[model samples]
Target: MFFNRQEIKFMFDENKRLNSKVKEFAKKNFHPKNFLFFSDSGSGKTTIAEKLAEELAKRREICYKSNDSKFIDYTNQEVLVKQELIHNTWLLKELLNLCEKDICPMNCKGKTKIDVMTKYNIITAQDPFDDIFNFKKRIFDENPAYSKDKRIGLHRRFSKSKDYTHGYMFKVTNRYQSGKVDFQITCLKESDDSAGDINDFVNGRFDIKFAEETTLEEAKKRVYDDDFENLYKHKGDVFLKREVDMDHVLGGVICDVDTENHTFSVYNKYFDSEIPSTMIPPKDLNRLNERLRNKIINQFGPDHEITGTNKRT
Candidate 1:
């Protein structure tokens, strides 16, 4: 026997009630030791969490004295991973330097783009694609200004003060199981604003930053290299004037800028690698700035608009 529309609506409302009841039960009875919440969207999971917190407060004297709530909405987990990688960048920088040497072992008479070097098949002894993606290429990109001696200044690029704050605001866990300090570490960046209790690099208090919240499905999805290529391909018209779009784009674009070298590495989100680095050529710097100014004007239009142009001439 099929139910009428009235009955169906009743069932839907009743189902919601039952869901809330179940959620309440799960929240109160279950102890969160090493737990993870996995559920579909709009399933009252988050609502249940709020309700549970209310219930817990009602049951006991709840304290909210701590001022450590900060939120950073990572565009995706890859960006979070990039932040973690930056935290342990000393180790990565060393490995990447060796890879750079392998790519350009000796002084060349002329400049060599990384892509060109790849085509020549001379930089194939070791592939660091998996280790740090295209970090080596970005760090060692051929630029006439920097490559005059066939050597790039790692000091300029790897300046810790310039790259990161001395505050050590980020944290990663390193576990030792076999009597050896584990070099391979699992990184977790908290999206919650709860990690702001510590001091940041410049003797200032650390504040949490958020990008946007990711759904359970998105959090669980596997990120890949092709995804990044697709993102770049569809980067769309850059209207830097729009704060919302800038935030969205910045979430996806993770780069380590070497202002001295005029080069920066864009992290490959999908492949867990680095893309070949790029630079604004010194010669074209002025032209690039002019073009960007024109593009912004074209996109945003003139600041002043005629207010009283309704009268017909």
Candidate 2:
């Protein structure tokens, strides 16, 4: 428990070095809004995540506060560590809590708050892909009306546009379960036309210009020929059409930490790619992972497999 001056200095230098490495890693990977940290149950993923979050808070001049597994709040930004899968309902609750506190300075209102409110968030999980997929499913399931609408359905399935800055028009066709087929056009961005279309759709009126049902051939022609000019004839300026996946909507960076190997890697699900791993000092890894294991066993019980195979005797 007692360390000489030299030993104390060595510890300080090592801690500083590790902090620098973590900051650099974050700068390179934390662009997306949603990020994940995955590894073995006792890999110290949460510990590293907390450190990263703290460093970010310091850099962003935000308050760093955490309440166990609930969330590591960093004012506008946060690291979500709730010991459960990330789903729409849970996420909405957490976001509302964050918003209610009015911690962030941004004055977001209405649907935009639900869609693109947060500046950044980190979600800790064991399986990143499964969590991401489940989150998207929850979104669709909870909003059945939106899911059934041809425009929303097609936008959810085929829209790959990542340009969040501009508006968009999606034209597609599908057969309903009632044995009725129709081509539908819808606008995704916030605009007068899109707003009117949404109001009409909600009021049981499909007479809006944007919700017009046309032939499949015509829809294909507009989509394939990049026919924004004709489509937006009276609407507004032309907007680009692209796929907008869930990853884009829930943007963030993901980091996968490997405690056994004393390294951590970053991943951006939107790009579907993995960044290389950065080596952690073995001493730091051993100390953090041991602390994490003990904490997990204490919280979840010794029988929890995360405590590792060698059970306490």
Candidate 3:
């Protein structure tokens, strides 16, 4: 909700564009591919990427059951849905299952568990880069029980499969709330053999870059200004003047307007507390009550009681 409708739409479209590029590569190469997205903290990259993942999973007939934390592949009834309690373990099991048969995992009977991992998979590995190396070793080199021919078959199936889709989310800049690890290092290493930088997919590198950063305070101010403008158009200057004067007298910021209580709450930064409407001047308080009463009358055909205003309506 921090972004407006148009902003949200653009974010979704941009991610879809990136996904399309991955799909195009998969189609042409007949191999699985992944993507990496980098942006500053609080840029909503995770939100947008997760949404695209969910959408793609649904298209692939894969859905996640939150109660059991398992991704169910509705298309493949034979494969059991595994609970994703451990990332590395879950990934290992899925890949091992794919290797159970010699056929390409992409053209197998049903969608793979990797298809339903909307949150984070190998593509978004936040752990150390060694984890990836360990995974490769486990799959192809570490296991001694399997014959050399079996290991080679597994590697061929995995490398040739065109069904895998993954995305990596990385923050270009760190903030107070962001993690300290540099994910770009992992992303670059992962993409070294897969798809190149995102800019390679889209023409004009500027199109792939994120917009200018907007701070939380600046976003809130934009919402406040839009609300104030709309309210002024409806209620005129008298109501607006009283609201401003009340803010000045209370020496606090108007945090919220509680229409149901017929009061506007103010937050005093000095004391870190909210000032009650009782602290407002009697004249301004009366004007606010009158405004609410008029609003109720005009909305409810002038038959509603003065104290019977419903905020929901």
Candidate 3 residue lDDT tens string, 147-260: 444334323322212212222223333331321112231223222222223221111011111112433343233222443432221211111111123222222323233333
Per-residue accuracy of model 1 over 251-296 as CA lDDT, tens digit each:
1221233323322221112222322222111211122224433432
If the candidates were sorted by their lDDT against the true structure, best first, what order would they fall in?
2, 3, 1
Q: Write the per-residue lDDT of candidate 2 for residues 210-293, one digit (tens) a residue.
A: 223343344343232443432331242232222211111212221233323222222222222222222111212122234443
Off by over 4 Å in 3: 1-29, 35-46, 54-62, 65-88, 96-123, 132-195, 200-313
Q: Give the winner by TM-score.
A: 3
For every model shown, the clashing-pair count is 19, 16, 0
> What Cα-based lDDT does every candidate model obtain?
0.22, 0.30, 0.30
Arranged by TM-score, best first = 3, 2, 1
